[model samples]
Target: MSGNLADGERAGAARPCLEIACDESGSDGENLTGGNTDVFAHASVSLSVTAAAAAVRETRDRIRSPAEEYKANHLLREKHRAVLEWLLATDGPIHGRARVHLMEKTYFVVDRAVSLLLDDPEGAVTLFREGRRTFGEEGWRAFLDAANRLLRVRPNGDPVEIFYGTADSLARAHPGTDAARILERLAATRPRAESYRAGCADGPPLIPVLNPLLPAIVRTAALWSGDGRPVTLVHDRQNMLTPDRIAWIEQTARRAGVGLAGVRLVVARDDARVQVADFLAGIARKIASDELNGRADPALTALLRPYVDPASVWGDARSRALLADPVAG
Candidate 1:
């Protein structure tokens, strides 16, 4: 299926905007660490808007799967290595090239943020839902302070253990306040910072998975839209792009001095370009996972390295360095 805007709309559209098709793997916002997958990945492939429609049709013609829809993981499992090699090849319909950013869940104290919020449920939930949204360390600190003020604790109870009794006490003590409202707000806001924390004594503070992913996507958009056209992003349907995450992406892009004309989420089966991105992202995810597990596949690495964008590999500088010099590290 085509991903480009229709002919009638092109005249009104921005002059030089780039259209990007993206896909992801191993993304579970709430269960980043507890889930089976540890690494969260987002991969984007960009193309000039002028070429997008044709490219989508052409790419779809190349798929050999019997299934009505195509997915990256499926191809990797069933097809010969050449199928992946061909997809990532320079001659493929993908015009702008592929870039991927991944975050390893273990590198940061993944559970600290959520656990902290859980401990001070009343305070944590209040700030998360009511406090002005912020990013990085500065934002997290402000949230914590705001949340602490809303809680009542004994001298020994640091976070004020929140339970049924605590809720009842809070409701009785503050007749005007709604304890149920607080609980509802907390449930809604918890996932916003589920993978983050104010501080982690064992490791660096948690960077929400989306923080890195959005920036990387924006950078790619900037590169593709250098000609003065706005950028439009299209991605496969996934949980990572929840309303809060989308807000975070736009906010983050603004902070980074980047612009996105539009962001579209579509089913992979309905969009050929996203299917192509899925294939590429799937390959990258597998390779990265293998490297992390110390089961590097030299043949596969050698085949795919030439297709990878040097700038948009995994997030860690060390991982990039290792990918560059696998034997040395």
Candidate 2:
């Protein structure tokens, strides 16, 4: 929203607001400690929920990369060690494997966000001091800064928000909180499991503006291979995303201050009112194809459906089937 501004003012102020989310999915790794299974390769995704943008360039960057090491343990070091090392510069209360719990690189994604906006990063720490101090924000800002800088993007004026959740939350939750049932479920699995039922257990949060860090969150929504490597960038490509996915992605776009509807108006004026829905329609058809071919799971595709438009999301099908559904054509 620009108003009463000189030409340069509008140009410089064209920054976007973004709500970012990052989460990692881990499969049951073969190696188990005390019956606890380590997470497999840690993957990350950063999404921008805006009017007419996506991580297509970023996604292609990832896909184009020559297949390389995708192992979690190999890439991620323990956070305690890194933090403690910075704290003491030598041995202290925490040291060695016994003193610290090894964490994956995924844990650092949020911290990256914080470093983006803050100078000394104490800017974030001061905010934490106001709370119970579960964790510091400075580290997150630093990580975020690194990401933005890595992408050669400026941070100022781009509204950014971040959080961590899990696929467990996306799954249907049943009533009757039973500790016994929970314990039993964990015991039944060959590999041990941990659930964050309290934090972000209420389904995936919408981060409309896809920013530098959103890939980390969207990673959770994608389909993972046997080793937890992300197989599909968009989950909705699995079966047939519904109007529901379009509806949600619409919210995400609006929340991020990116105007897909507006973009369609300028670039895709033909039935632009339903461009978002049409884009998603294509994504849904892809998901259906994958399901029939055993390439992806229905649940995963359902999530991707919310992010694409029916008519142009996938963009093709001179010979593809067209649905005579309510909103189509």
Q: Which candidate number would show the highest TM-score if scored against the true structure?
A: 1
Provide the lowest-lDDT 10-residue window in model 2: 93-102
Off by over 4 Å in 1: 1-15, 48-63, 108-228, 240-244, 306-318, 324-329
Q: Score every model by TM-score.
A: 0.56, 0.18
- Scored by CA lDDT, what does every candidate get? 0.52, 0.26
Candidate 2 regions exceeding 4 Å error are 1-108, 112-245, 255-257, 262-329
lDDT per residue as tens, model 1, 1-329: 11345466766665555677887776544343345765656667765444544654544565555666556665476445566666666675552265555556433222233334455534433433332232334533333333332221211223223222333343344344443345343444443332332232245322342233555566555544554456778977765467666666666665666666767889887776676677667777778778667877777766555445454434245556655433210
- Give per-residue CA lDDT, model 2, range 119-220, as digits (tens): 223423332232112222454233333333222222233212211111122111322333122212322321111122112235533331112123321222
Q: Where does the lowest 10-residue lDDT sum fall in candidate 1?
A: 148-157
Estimate the lDDT of model 2: 0.26
Error of 2 at 281 (Å): 22
Q: Count the backbone clashes (under 3 Å) in each candidate.
A: 1, 59
